[model samples]
Target: MLTAHTAEGELVILTRSQSLESLRERRKQESFYCPQCKEQLILKVGDLVIPHFAHYQQSSCRNSFSEGESPAHLLGKSQLYEFFSHHTPAVKLEPFLPDIQQRPDLLVVWGDTEVPVEFQCSTISTSLVRQRNAGYYLLNMLPVWIILTPQSIQTSTADILTLRLSSFLQFFIRQIPNRMSVLLTYHPQSERFYYLSPIIHLQGSTYAARHLTLSLHKQTVPFSLPSSPSQTDIRELALHYQSARRKYLRTVIAYNQKGIHNQFLRACYEMRIQPVQLPAWIGVPVQGQEAFRQSDCEWQLLFVAAVRETRKSPDQLNTSFFHTFIKQFDGEPDDLLAACRSYGDFLREERIDIYRMDRFTDGDFVYEVLSGRFLAMYAKN
Candidate 1:
């Protein structure tokens, strides 16, 4: 086998153990050979299939067959399995399902017809014939057949440990794509292949050494199901529904404010905030404060509100303060101010005092924030 280097992108080839050992011995151009024929081999920087070899054209000597391995071949089996499992329909292509028992080299079921695939490149045997002929009678499945005619390897490199039949003989006979391709983003660094477009009847390969990747220009199957919570299941959820009547009641609800609630929670994340039930929920605060185990509820609420800078503090509000915080259009610089003003306006109507801060020009912003506080407090029982 020959090897060509200086190629772009990433590639790894498994050479012989002695080849590496000899390079350390002389560290110079040397002779490697076919393990079978002992003929001289070639090695040069080449294309995608690197360190390639060619016959000398004078002798019939060449690489025969043996156990070998290749990075591409390994990647092929993996990608092929995943692709088939995901796309091959269990219903439409029921007959072709792989048989775990009496496993043939390769099985193909086109409708009820079965065929056994085999390779007859350098060697042929009666075992292959008997296997293919008696495939389904013994295994009850189709016999899909395949063969390989490998080229003879002649090399001059003396330390040719890289020559193994395992290197090139990949066992990837999978169902072809019947749909379109899903154009996925291929990131070689991470060995990731992300599909964006749906490619039909796709044929591709994947290599996962340090990274996961699928060979591009392959089929994409549209094989997925959307799973959503059913309406009945949603109605049965106890998180917000109180009763059967509430579940059945039809109402026009616009927008869930969970994200807003989450934002407020995010702002107060570091303040050691706790959830508190409203006085109404506890049957007038005196009825259920013990289960919560805390006093100074109003003070904590007020302090936490100011600290989060949510402008929800029930301190005081004036129309000018509202103007400072409110923006006419969405996402203006003063939109945060508007948010603050909106909270203040809501509070003023609820009996907070009236004061506005425009420009402090002297003190910290928190001082401006906490200057006015709600005098009334909610004490935990």
Candidate 2:
């Protein structure tokens, strides 16, 4: 808590220029209170910690601030407050909004919008994320979350920009309208921002992304998304996607269970095909791959097997059947349907017969689907 109210109901902000001796003297004369809870506060002008107001240990205020706030969180919040203050006159440090019963680290007015900037330096749950966003949306205020950079970020290859997104971190990902999805993070120590933009989910947690770093000094009030990847960059990413798909095939052969109880393996067995020996077209990367938590190969193989069991020809392939088939597997309905439809459309367009699986064994065809056709589909003209 950085702001407080004096006995005279005057607001006192610690960030403003005020002598410590004068504050200590004032502490002796009058009592300061919390702006949100209206409870009495203790002003701590310590040598180690930053000068700020803290509530009493036994205070029953529901709007209690600074209980679990770490030193990093405090430092980042203060730095962001100063940074946003420079850009707009309507910047506030930890403003408690009674309407939502939420206190954002910083709130800045951008044009006619009130943006709540959350400097999250700790782990958060998905429900909590949804709740906070819902609260902000309820008030017609857009919320921006800048997470503290993790200690390590794993990359798939040194040549291309890639990231392994854990389920927890995936909660931070946001998709702007008519733009790509991105995750924004900040390092308070370096005072730099790491923007993971145009994230393409290869399979499961593996994603092909572009990382952009920007110093706080160069940042603006409304942050900007990085430019789209160039042709060469997208080509490299496509190669990475190909590598991941190859690795998935290898992993399925080596690590996954092959028993009759194993769903994907059972389907492969019934189709008289080895899991690794499946056609390259079955597991090729497509848009909306993020909907599945498992490797796209698993569900995609099952889908092809189901189609083969029906003995459907190119013209006889029913999209409604494909949608219902994908619905049995867990995922976002629209996205799952889109991915299945893309694969089904490719089969029909190529006039490939699902029953006669022996016709399409071109391993290089996967690259064509990913690099040529898939990339062209997403490419901005």
Candidate 3:
């Protein structure tokens, strides 16, 4: 805790000017109390750590001290409060919201807009994150979740950062321009904010993210969706998709002890289709399809197989077929629909007459390749 109340109800903050000797002198004469609970607090001044107040061992002040509130968390919270307070006088530190029964790390009010800034320094469950987000939404407040750095992520490649996707981290994924989603984190030690944009789910619990670091002192933190993808962004996405596909294939092949266990591979073999050299249109990357359990290549192969089946009876391309095709996999309907639309766009580029139907009442529409010429036009780019 940075600020505490004295016995006279006077607020005393451990200022930067105060050294160990000064803190020791002040502690000898004045008594401190927890700002939230109004319980007595002891001041500790040490050479290794910052000067702060701590509740006594037997104290049960849940309101004053949260669970797992480490020294780093305390320091980060204080620094964030100071940062916002410097910019706006309306900033309040740890303001209790009666309606939601939650106290955000900091609340900044600007006219009609109230932003609850949460500096998350620890890993938390997705349900808790959703509950908090839902609570804020119900109160008509935009909650900003800023992940505290160092522990939140790790550097992967020259341009990528790997973030372990917890439910908390997933809540922060924002879709930017050019059909890419990103997560943001703040590093207080360096006074820099990082954006892990265009994040691609590599496999379970991990994502390959393109990193963008911004100086907190220079740039305002972005709260809006980013603009369209650049050529470089698209190129990076292509590379990531290809690499992910290769990795997925290697794992499947290694695990197929009693011959290929995957039904998709068996179907491909019957059609004499090489898994790695699927047609260009088959494995193209689509925006917002990360919810699908299957890899991009796997889903694309399934779609291609559907196209081949439809060629047998063109009139069979209807709502029932579409629903059955999608039901074969475990994926979000909305995400599958989005990927279908993207696939339709690719077909148009190739001069194929595939159309995405929207009249279906069961769910969102699916794409249909109009002619068998779609198969003959296939080429590996």
lDDT of each: 0.29, 0.74, 0.64
Candidate 1 lDDT tens digits, 218-290: 4343323112223332222211212211221111011112233332233234443323211111111111111
Q: List the lowest-lDDT window of 10 residues for candidate 1.
A: 202-211
Q: Clashes in each model (backbone N, CA, C under 3 Å)?
A: 68, 0, 5
Better candidate number, 1 or 3, judged by lDDT:
3
Best by lDDT: 2
Q: Model 2 lDDT vs. the true structure? A: 0.74
Q: Show model 2 residue runs off by greater than 4 Å.
A: 16-31, 45-49, 154-163, 177-179, 255-260, 313-316, 349-352, 359-362, 365-381
Q: How do these models rank on TM-score, best leading?
A: 2, 3, 1
List runs of model 1 lying over 4 Å from the truth.
Answer: 1-76, 90-101, 105-122, 149-381
Sorting all predicted structures by lDDT, with the top scorer first, yields: 2, 3, 1
Model 1, residue 97: distance off in Å is 12
Error of 3 at 79 (Å): 2.1
lDDT of 3 by residue, 84-135 (tens): 7666657776666878888787788755588998888787786787888899
Q: Cα deviation of 153 in candidate 2 (Å)?
A: 3.1
Candidate 2, residues 87-127, lDDT tens digits: the string is 88788888888888999998898788889999888888878
Model 3 RMSD in Å is 7.5
